[model samples]
Target chain A: MKGSSPLVRPGAPGRAGGPDTTRQAGHRATGTGSRRAARSERLAPYVLVAPAVLIILGLRLYPLILGVNFSFTGDGDRNGMVVGLDNYLELADDPLFRTALGNVGLLVLLLPVAVAIPGLLATFIYLRVPGHRVFRSVYFFPAVLSPVIVGSIFNLMLAFDGPLNTVLGTIGIGPVDWLGDPGVTMFTVVGVHVWATFGMALVVFLAGFSTLDSSLLDAAQMDGASLARTIWHVVIPSLSRTIAFVLVTTMIGMLTSMFGLLYVMTSGGPEGSTYLPEYYIWIQQGQMNRPALASAASTVLFLIMLVVGLAQVGLLRRAGRQD
Target chain B: MKQRTLWSAVLVAGLTVSGCGSATRTAPSPAGSGTSSKLVVWDWKSGDATAASYIEKAKADFAKKHPDVTVEFVAQPFDQYYTLLGTAIQSSTGPDVMLFNGGGQLRDRVDALLPIDEYVAEDRQRLAGWDAFSKDGKVYAAPVTLQGHPIYYNKEVYEKAGLDPAKPPATWDELMTDCAAVKKAGKSCFALGNKEGFGIQFFLSGLGSGVLTPQEYDDWIAGKRDWTSPHVKQIFTLWKDVNDKGYNNPGANSTAMFNDSWAIFQSGKAANVIGLMSDIGHWKDFGEFLPPDKIGVMPAPVVTDGATPSLAYDGGIGYGVAKWTKDPKLAADLVRSLTSTEALTAFYAKAGAIASDTTIDASQSGPAAGAIVSAIKGGKPALHVALSSKTLDLMGRVSQKLLSGSLTVDKAMDQMAAADKAS
Candidate 1:
């Protein structure tokens, strides 16, 4: 989305303040009689921005520093002691923490699948596939439910003797241990997380579609472009910015917000294969009473999010520009 | 309550002054207990419907002695109770009195609790689980209820399998044969749930008495455990073997013990379940689904010759005075009232808690209760309770691995031993 200019847009045509008109106004406003007015006007933007700047510093930046500081300390008998890097050392030694990091890597690899599911659905809806109106509402219904509710409902449906398996068994397929198998649990949890969150991304795509050039679609149809070719040549290039935004937010959501699903669905168990950094931090801080170690995990998780997110946005931007 | 608080303040103050206090910073309030007269109590049970009458009775008991003091009970969700308490302790701002589970859970945080030994001295003979609430000979909490794992069999299931419910199996081989019969009858032998890895804990402790010899049982609790011992290894082997043999309900790994596993046994989907003796998941609970007569207590079948089967029990839930309390004596008095004979009797009657007060009558509940009550006299501490929180957590994960075939019993035992040693 592009930022809107209510008052001044520098190079746009027929705006209230043209560049030539602004120069004449600036000369009159800075004259001897209006010097005080000009000075205060110069300070207005900073005045408008002060509250948000202060809030971000206090709530956001301060906590990050506090957490990083805590990560260096010790827990339990050594509470409040500066046993530098001891907590981080212990975090490294923990197999569960390693599993959490591995899970993060897995999520990164699966990021495109998560993005594509909603992207493809929105595309179909935009093209007005049969029952598209009903499909749009129905497909997005699960996303309205909280992750806790989604996880619980899935708990029943994905059980060994659950409905999903019962359906599979009719065709002699399986009674898969969906949440218990180490190999399957992570995917199951990620799938549920996406199931419960895809609607938000779908809404974003729909809004992007509203701004899409419909004439291009008609022109493509007038030519001989296939549906796949049309999407690749026309739709993809036009919606690149929205896709980039969705990718960053979805990756962030997967890394930080899957804690609830992991907690409710598996408790990071079935051999801790479903462990994510957020869940691991919770176990360390909450269950194990090792606040320092939890802080260390939190720091690592934050770094992981930062590095992955920035790289993704930059890559997306370069891709968008090239297109 | 005021007078007792003054006495306790002086006593604890003297200890701190002499530099022998367990926690020195939580000094008595200078304005006295008057400023902090509103005594807040935190627990996970007060919100539970079954425990409502019990909390009310305890509150009434406390009110009689200190009507001037206001008592506020905060019911915390059980899953997040410890984490919330940990946060409060870190901030040095929390309830005056709080509930604690016994053994490693209490032992781990005993430093944050005021020793109520002197305050609770009068009730020593009445309560039986002091060891669980005590650390290094100093009692930090007063026991309110006893929790134990007791193997409960469905008499109807046994009868349907053509085995006389009156004459249940008494040995491992007999149990296996009976399980085969039950299996053939289209019901799993056990309704096991290991979702939280708690099923394995229940399995180990419930059957441990019949797996370990008398000397081995006592030795394990005394910090002389031999995890590599064949008998110890057998417990894990049975855990793996039973699941492998299809003796448990399907999806045991995903099924929760609190309700799902119990539901199977309640609906007669399984023959037996290693159930608890207090709170939820007990005889009282199972009785609600199946007729009380159908729910029968059975000691674990003898796994090895000379292995004595006994009930595995310990202090279930207890109330402790927080170090930050304005009135340790007042909080301790509340603990005493919570565990008082009259209060506990109401608790046992209404909530089906095996009240810490032994004087509370148990016969009225039923035959299963009678058997459990009789067995309590000979019961030993549960095998799992001896484990530290860290070790128990490791065991939970490894036990899951064992079930999933990723890990072997011997390797699991080695990991458990390593965690135990680190603890």
Candidate 2:
């Protein structure tokens, strides 16, 4: 620990050879020592990158490639045999799968709403509103909960004769079928998911807010600029990268991680109206026992995620440039 | 340092995002069964308190035959049972023996099982409803419990509605009239939960006998299903009609059938429910909520004028040997022991199953059990149970849509017919 400090510090000497043999700077720069030094310098980048590169190849890229390959196979009687897109052909004809894809489109349309909720809250917190610390903790508590717990809590609240209906009835509003109606179940599930997860995005936005320049806000207030104008002209341009990160993460969260909520809340029910690709893959692979067909659905989901992620990055970068 | 931390964070997040990938997982390698000391069994029952004694009895029975062989029972959660089984099937190596629900679920996965007809020849006459676990006349699993759809009436609701519980409806018109009276008294006639699509299966099997002509009932079970038949269409029509007429509890489309629909009946919110004969949502569960006398089991009311009503039942659950087992004879022996009279008797006594063993003393189980046992003699294989898993799955969604008035009965029936033909 004593001598190695200089070894890691850039431009530091004393990282030569055995003990005091080549510790002398004049000896280290001669013949074979210089060649070894050059070689180690060349190897530094690879050493730094090894862990992250191996993790991505092993965990992310490998499973994705494996999933796409498996989509060509057959299930049941034809277990291991490759059928070459028979599963995709079947998915095209299936209405339930189509509904799942349609729900993905619905999620895309609601992306802005999900991002804005947390973005606005972060701003309020950044402004140091009354009891901000307490509000931050209370708002972020739901994000710490597992979706199963959240979904179960919402399931009790959203029952037909549950407290929500009772409260609505007291206010002279007609009882809305939160989960029983085919058209309403998907929205109810998505609303619960957003409620449960927005805190994560809120925390991220707060971190971005911490890095914001205080002088710009002070000048805006002095100039009699409205809160909306300040956020639009200053905060938006400064935090574009953070907003982009939140948008991509939130979209991915909706697509991949809402399975637990969908599973518990509506179970893609009220006549299969809430079938997301993630849940559709579950049904095909688990309930329907069509693992091969599930793979095809998964491959399509992967492609959708790729397109959506790239679009987000592109859109955010362009907006940042314009600013 | 910041760049490295960011890369680590991004990679960790990437790894955490997962979905149900269709890629088959590597299955546990097959355990050599010939002279092997261990035999593992997979089921959703062994962990259940009531089913524990049954498992013990079954293991003892098997132990008598193979004194040195040991047994292992792995109980899976009921909800995730099939998915786990599907995973095991794909890998070609799982448990030496497994439990299966009787119908299309068993039929669809027969390739993974060893047909035990030769091993169980002696027990054939004692047990009933073997057809439910068979495909093309070859038995895939032995019947342990008889599951059926019986009309269980809440006599408290009937009495409250100013009707005699003793005289449950004898015809469709009478049932509707009673439902109207119940509604007038601020109660629903039926407690239906179609959320998982199982409510429709119970409905189809429960009321189908009263709707289809006796010939059509036999034909439907015999693989000669006539989707275009008016009587068949009437089953789906009556399903929607009851819900539309406010005969069922509100939110029937959203309610889950597992115990929620049964809860409505138990709480006396409904007059009757087309419920299971075994396991749950039966006389035993309802007996706890209502007095024993108030829990009445009645035959389905007549829907079609000329139709002869009969109890609709089949093998409920059974034990099957895996195809990869090294010793077929030993695994089959284990299946036989699992369904043995002594084992099934303990199952019935503690679990309240209407055991497949016809000789079991069910007289002590009360009048409701007696009625179900007597009905089994005339009962046909359930109409819904006869359909393949694919068809049953399709029927559930279609039935839900039919209840919501999104799809017509004819259109649903057409889809079911197409699925049936393909399967």
Docking quality of model 2: it rates as acceptable
lDDT of 2 by residue, B1-423 (tens): 112323543564443221112212222224654554667788899999999899999999999999978888878778867766766676666688889988878888898988889999999999998988998889989999999999889888999999998899999999999999999999999999888889899998999999999988999888999999998898888999999998999888888787788999999999999998888889887878787777888888998888888999999998888998867898899999998999999999899789999888777777778888888888899888778777877888898899888998889988988999998
Clashing pairs in 1: none
Quick one: RMSD of model 1?
A: 8.2
Q: Which residue pairs in model 2 clash with each other?
A: none
- What fraction of correct interface contacts does each candidate retain? 0.49, 0.39
Q: What lDDT would each prediction earn against the true structure?
A: 0.83, 0.84
* lDDT string, candidate 2, A206-230, tens digits: 9999989999999999999999999
lDDT by residue for model 1 (B1-423), tens: 112222433454454343322222233344454544677788898887877877788889998998877788878778757756766676666678889999878888887899888999899987877888999889999998899999999999999999999888889899999999999999999999888889989999999999999999999988999999999999999999999998989888888776789989999999999988888888888888888878889998999899999999999999999997877788888988888888788778778778887776687687788788878778899999898778888888998888888999989999999999988
Scanning candidate 2 chain B in windows of ten residues, the lowest lDDT window is: B18-27
Alpha-carbon DockQ of candidate 1: 0.29
Interface RMSD (Cα, Å) for model 2: 7.0
